[model samples]
Target: MLRFFFVLAVVVPWTVGQPVDLEREIREAFNLGGFPSLAVAVVVGDDSPVMEVHGWADRAAGQRATRATQYRIGGLSKVFTATLLVQLRDEGRLGLDDPVSKFLPEGVKLPADPRGARYITLRHLATHSSGLPRNPVSRTERESDPWNGYSVQRLYEGLARTKLAFPTGASGRYSNLGVGLLGHALGRSLDMPFEDALRRKLLAPLGMSSTRIAMSPAQLKSVATPYARQDPSKIVRAWDYGCLAGCGGITSNLPDLRRFVSLNLRAGLSGVEPVRGASLTELHTPQRIWDGWSKATGLVWIVDHTRDAGDIVWHSGGSQGFASWLGFSPRWKIGVIVLTNCGRPVDDVGNRLLRQALKKYRKLSPKFRAMAERLVPHLVATPGDKVKGLFHEDFLKDVPFSVLKNVLSGLAKKHGACSRVLRVDPADRPELANVVFQFADLSLVTGKMGVSEGDPAKIVYLRFGR
Candidate 1:
C-alpha cells in the first residue's frame, strides 16, 4: 500500500472587495457554449479550490453534474504519464537521457531510422520529439473509437513496420505514440501495468482518488454521458485506450482535479512521498525551445508566455465527446481545471477563469500601481531611445529599445491608441502590475509592467500578449 500524507494549508492574503460570481460565470459560459455538462475548479494560492458544475451529467438519466461527476480527460493523461516518468527518474530507477529501448521487454521491436532504434531517449518521448507518428497505422479495421482496439501486441508490431518521421531531437511534434510508449516503458520498469504503476506513484500519494484510466463501480455511477456535437440526445461511448492509455484514457472529477492542481502549485510543499520536489521542478523546466523559442515544451506540459501571467504550463485534452484543459502558474500560485462533456473546446474558458481567479485574489500595492500608471503610457508614446532611458540598465540591455518600440508600435496599430487606464492591479511578482487599458476602439488590453525597487523605480519589463 502506498503511504500518503496531508499537507498543512497555508493561508493566502486575498484582495479586499473583489466581487466575482464564479458560479454564475461558469453557468453562463456553459449555456452560451451549449455544452451538455461542464465542471470547473479554480485554485488561488494554497486554499482549497472553488469548484462549480453546470448542466447535466446524463440528461436521459436526469442526473445533474456536480464537483464529483467524472469525465474522460483525454490527452490530459499524457501529463500524468510524464509525471510518473519524472518520479521514476527521481528514485534513480531510470534516467531521462537513457535510451527508451533499455526499458522495453526482450524481443520487443522499435522502429529504426538510418542510425537505429537507440537514437530515441526517454527525454525525447516525454518532450514529444521522438520522431514517432501520432498514432500507429491500423492493421485491423478501425473502431468507432480509434484507441479501443489498439492492443499492446499491435503496438509493437506497428512500430516494427513504421518509419521515422524525423531524426530524434531534430524537431518537436505532438506524438501520442511516443508518450504511450513512455508510459509502457515506465510500467515495465515497475514490473506492473501502466494504470497500477500510476496509482502507486502518483494518484494514491497525491489524494487524487477519483482519477483513473478505468472507473470504479461507484465512480461509474457519477460518470458524465458525453454528447456528440449538435446532438445532445446521442450519447457517445467512452474510449478504451487498451495499450495507449497514456495518450488519452483517464477519467476524473473536479474535486480530484483540484487536488492534482494543488499538487502542481504546491509541488515542493505537498508532502507526497512518491514525488520528489526536485522531480516537479525538473518537469516544469523548459526541456526544448521549438520554433525559435516562440513556445517551449517541458515534459508533456506546454510552456506559454503571456503578458500578464508570465510562464504558464498547460495542456488540453479531447476524446470522443469530452474536452478538458489544465493549467497552472507556479509564480502566481494559481491553477485551473475545466472539463466539458461535449466535443467543443474549453481551453479558452479555463484560461479566462484562471485570470479571473488571480485578479480576484491579488491585492495591488500602491507603489506598483503608481509605477504602471506613469510608465505604460510613456513607453507607448515615447521614442525608442527615450523609452530605453526609463528602463533599468540590465533590462534595457536584455530587451533592446528597438525591439520594445516595434512591439508597442504593432500593438498601437492593431488596437488603436490607448484612450485611458481602466485599472492597475497586482501581478504574480510584487514588482510588476497589470494595467488594463481602454483602447480608442473601445477594446481592452491588459499589460504587465515591471518596475525596479530603487528610489525612483525604472521599468524592468513590459509584456502584452495572450
Candidate 2:
C-alpha cells in the first residue's frame, strides 16, 4: 500500500454540513463483518451515551440484538478482577507487591523457579508478567469446551507440574492462568468465591446486576446465542470458567459496559465505594513497557498512544464464540464499547469509531485553525521546492523531498486542487498539528505535521493517511 499520503475519498465525506455519523460507520462494519450480531455504545464527554445494535441475537430463533442483549466480554473480566485487587490493596487488606504464595489456597502452590528462587507477586499476575503459560492444560484436553470441566483441584494438580516460561518480571507474556490464579487467591483471602467477592466489592456497588459469570435463567434468555466463527450456523455453548472465571468468564451488555467506561473516565468523581481515584489510576498506569513504549500493560488495561487521539486505555477480549473491545480516552472523556456474538475480532471497528469520536468531540482553537489554513495551499498545489522549505532539515533527511513530492503529485493527479479544510486537531504541544482537507473533487485526506523544536514554523515531521 502507499504508506506516505493516502486518499479517503470513498470512506469519509468532504461535503460541508454533513457530520461524520458513527452509527452509519458501525453499521457498515457490521455488514462487512458478517457476524451473527453486534452492539455498540459510545460516550462523548458528559453527553448521554448513544447505543446501537445490528443483526440478530439468536439468528436461528429470529431474535434481533438489542440494547439489553448480553454477550460474553471474554478477557475483559481480568480488568474487574485486577480492580478488586487494587481495592483490597487500598483497604490495607493486601499489598500489590505481596507474594502470590501468601494468598494461595492452603494446599495449592504455583510452580517455583527451579533454576533459582523467584517470588511472583500479585502485581506480576495482574500484569501478565508472572512467567506462567497462557493456559493450565493442553488444547487436546479442553477441545471446544475449554474451561467447563476444569475444577479447582485440577488446576492445582496442573500447577504442581508446571514450569515457568521465564523468571518473574524478566519480561511480559500474556497468561490467562496467571490472572485466574490471582482471582483464586483473592477469593481465598476474602473467604468467599471470586464471583461473590467481585459482586459485593464492585458490580453491585456500580449497579451492574446484569454482569456476572453465570447468568440466572431470566438473564440467560437475554444472552445473544454464541456461534462458531467459521460457521455461524453452528451453535457454540457459553463458556463456564469454573475456577478460572477471573480470566474470561463474564457476560455483560452495552448499558452495563457504558456505565463501567463512564466510571473509569470519572475515576475520582464516582462517589461509589471501592472505586477510588487512586485505585483506578493504578489500574491504568503502565507497569511494563512493550513495543518500544508506544504500548504498555497496566494491571489488566492496555495503554496505547496515537498521534490522532493521544493516549488510549483499552482492552480487547475473545472467547470460543464471542469478541469484545472497550476503549477510552481519559483526556478526551470519550469511550467506545463493541460486542459481537461471534469470535471474530471487532477491534478494528471499535478503533475506527474511537477515531471518529475523537475528531467530533475535539474543538480546534483559532490559532490552530489558522495554522491549518496557512499550510493547505502549499500542501495541495505547491511544487517540490516550495513544500521542501516548509519542513525542517531533520525531517527531509528521513523522508527525502523526492519521496514527498511524488506522493503529493499522485494525490493532485487523482483528486485535483484542494477546496477547504474540514478539521484541525492540535496536539498537546502547540507546534504539532493534524488537518483533514477536502479537495476540489470533494475527496477527503488527513495530513499531519510537526514543527522543529528550534524553529516552530518549519516542519520536522509529516504524515498523510486515509
Candidate 3:
C-alpha cells in the first residue's frame, strides 16, 4: 500500500472552458499503480507548466515527495546526448553523415563488423541503426550495476569484438552502445568530457538547474529512495552508467524536466542558444520509419501517431530502481513528464494522463442540465422517496433511494449547493452524459446520468464520483 500527499505547484488557468482536474487524475494513477513516490508535470500551450507530487520520497522517514525530489530519468539521457550532437553539427564541427571512426581517440579501434565500420555513420548511431549491440561486452562483477566498471578502454575493446546483428542503416533497432558511442564521439569532437559538453551546450542555456549526470551533496539529500519492484522493503542501489552514462545516467526532478518538455513543445523557440534552429528542426524530424511498431524515429525520440492526439514524440526509460517518461505533442502544444522511484514501469500511467489532457469538454446538453437541476435540488431538500422517482430502474437496482439521498446530502453539507454545470462528456458513453458540477463552495465534482432516447426520455442510470 502506498500513501499519497497532494501538492500542486502551479495551477493551470481555466482556458479550455472546463476545469481539468489533473491533480485528481494523478492521484488516481498513483493509487492504482501503488507507486511509492511519483512526480508529474504538465505544460499546456504558452502557459506556465503545472506540477503535482504524490506519495513518499522516503517512506520510512515519512518525507513527502515534492517537485524538487530527484529521480533517475533512465534513457531520457539519450535525448540530451542526441541534442548535444545536433548542436555540434550546427557548429560545423561535425556532420551526421560522417563516419563515427573519424572522431574516435587515437589508437582506439572500432570492432570489426561483416558490413564494415565505414558503413556506420554518426546518423546511424543517433538513429539506433548503427548495427551496434545494446550493450558492450564487459566483465563487471556487479550484476545490479553492470555498467559501473566499464571504462573507455573496455568500451573500445568491446567494440573490437562486437558483431553487427543487422546490416548497417538497414533498420531501426534500439542500441544503448550505439548512442553511448555517439556521446563519446561528441566529447572527442569538442575535446571535453561528455558531461561538461552537455552542460556547456544544453543545460545552462535552458536554465535547467536540477538536471545532471552527477548530483551534488544538496541534490543527493533530495533524491528519492529507490525501491525494488518485487519487494518494496528492499531498496536498490542506483546503477552507475560509467562510460555509458550517455545511454541512461541522468537524474532529474519535475521542475527541471518541465522546462525540457516546454522547450520541445515550443520547438527551439525557448532560445536554446547552442542548438541552431536548423539543427533543432533536423533533430526532431523523423529520420527512420519503424514498420513493426507503426512509429518513427527522430534523433533519439520515438515519433508516435495517435488517432486522437495526432503526432506525439516521446520516450520512456528505466534504471535499476526508477522509471520515467516524457513526451510532447507539437500539434496540441501539450507536454507531460512522469517520474517514479519504484522499478515497475510507469510509461502507461504517463501515456494515459497525456491522453486525458488532450480530451476536449463541451457544454452539457439542455436535457442533461435540466435533469441535474431537478434531481439535485430534490435530493438535497427531501431525503428518500422524493429523489427515487428521478432515478432509472437500472440505477436503483444497485443504489437504493435512501443510500443515494445520504450520499447527496453528505456532498451538499461538505461542498455546499451545486451551482452550475461546468462541462459534459457525451462521447464517452452513448447512454450516459458525464457532467461536472461546480459547487457554491467553488469545488467541483462529476457525475454520469443515463437517459433513454424515447419520445419522452426518462432516467435509465446514474453514477457519481468517478
Worst window of 10 by summed lDDT in candidate 1? 1-10
Error of 2 at 149 (Å): 4.0
Off by over 4 Å in 2: 1-18, 46-48, 114-117, 138-140, 268-273, 363-424, 428-466
Whose lDDT is greatest here? 2
Superior by lDDT: candidate 1 or candidate 2: 2
Which is better, 1 or 3, measured by lDDT? 1
lDDT (0-100) at residue 43 of candidate 2? 78
Q: State TM-scores per candidate.
A: 0.76, 0.76, 0.71
Candidate 1, superposed: residue stretches over 4 Å from native: 1-21, 115-118, 139-143, 216-218, 267-274, 363-424, 427-430, 433-466
For each candidate in turn, give its C-alpha RMSD to the true structure in angstroms. 10.7, 8.1, 14.0
Candidate 2 per-residue lDDT, tens place, 1-466, comes to 1123223232244344458788788889888988888898887654535689999999878999999899999998899999899888878889998998898766766776755337889999999888989988632245678777458888888888788898877788999999988998898889898999999988898888889886678778998999988887678876777878899998999988887887788755546455787678778888998977899999989999776567789999998889999999876778999999998899998898988877666654455455556656654544547666666666666776777777666666678766777877656544456678777787788776554444355655556763
* Positional deviation of residue 296's Cα in model 1 after best superposition, in angstroms: 1.5
Cα RMSD, model 3: 14.0
Residue 41 in candidate 1 has what lDDT?
Answer: 84
> Candidate 3, clashing residue pairs?
111-159, 111-160
